[model samples]
Target: MPERAPHGTSPSHPSPEAYAALESLLRASPRGRWFLAEYARRNRTAETEMLLEAIARIERAVLKPAPRQAVPSNV
Candidate 1:
């Protein structure tokens, strides 16, 4: 069985590896992507909200801004 997350709390960071794999799969299969759209169109508002939330989480986790470098001091 796959490892399960505990109830009531979510992970801090989404798995980048998993995200890449899923993205590749979706991109490779137009039919699969179309199925997702069909399901979303047929589903209720809550279903769309759920997908939006998940996508947001992944975007946030993997697209964090890079840390800035300090300016050099004048001599």
Candidate 2:
């Protein structure tokens, strides 16, 4: 039997890996990339933008600036 989603609730957000896959697929085809971006923008889906924003935030968080190592003092 197929599992059902809880009533009045949708599935949770996709994983970062899944979102990265989707972004990669979209970029694979120029036309598809353009269309989805335009459609998503036109529809004004906060969810879509939020997902993209989350991805961006995740990327930044994962790749923060590294602390600079101090050089040895010259004699």
TM-scores, all models, native as reference: 0.36, 0.41
Q: How well is each residue in 1-75 modelled by candidate 1, as lDDT tens digits?
A: 976779988766659998888767876788978876776787867788899999999999889998898888983
Off by over 4 Å in 2: 1-7, 43-75
Residue pairs with clashing backbones, model 1: none
| Residue 2's lDDT in candidate 1 | 72
Q: Report how far off residue 21 is in candidate 2 (Å).
A: 0.6
Query: Cα lDDT of all candidates, in order?
Result: 0.82, 0.88
Off by over 4 Å in 1: 35-75
Q: For model 2, where is the 10-residue window of minimal lDDT? A: 39-48
lDDT of 2 at 26: 85
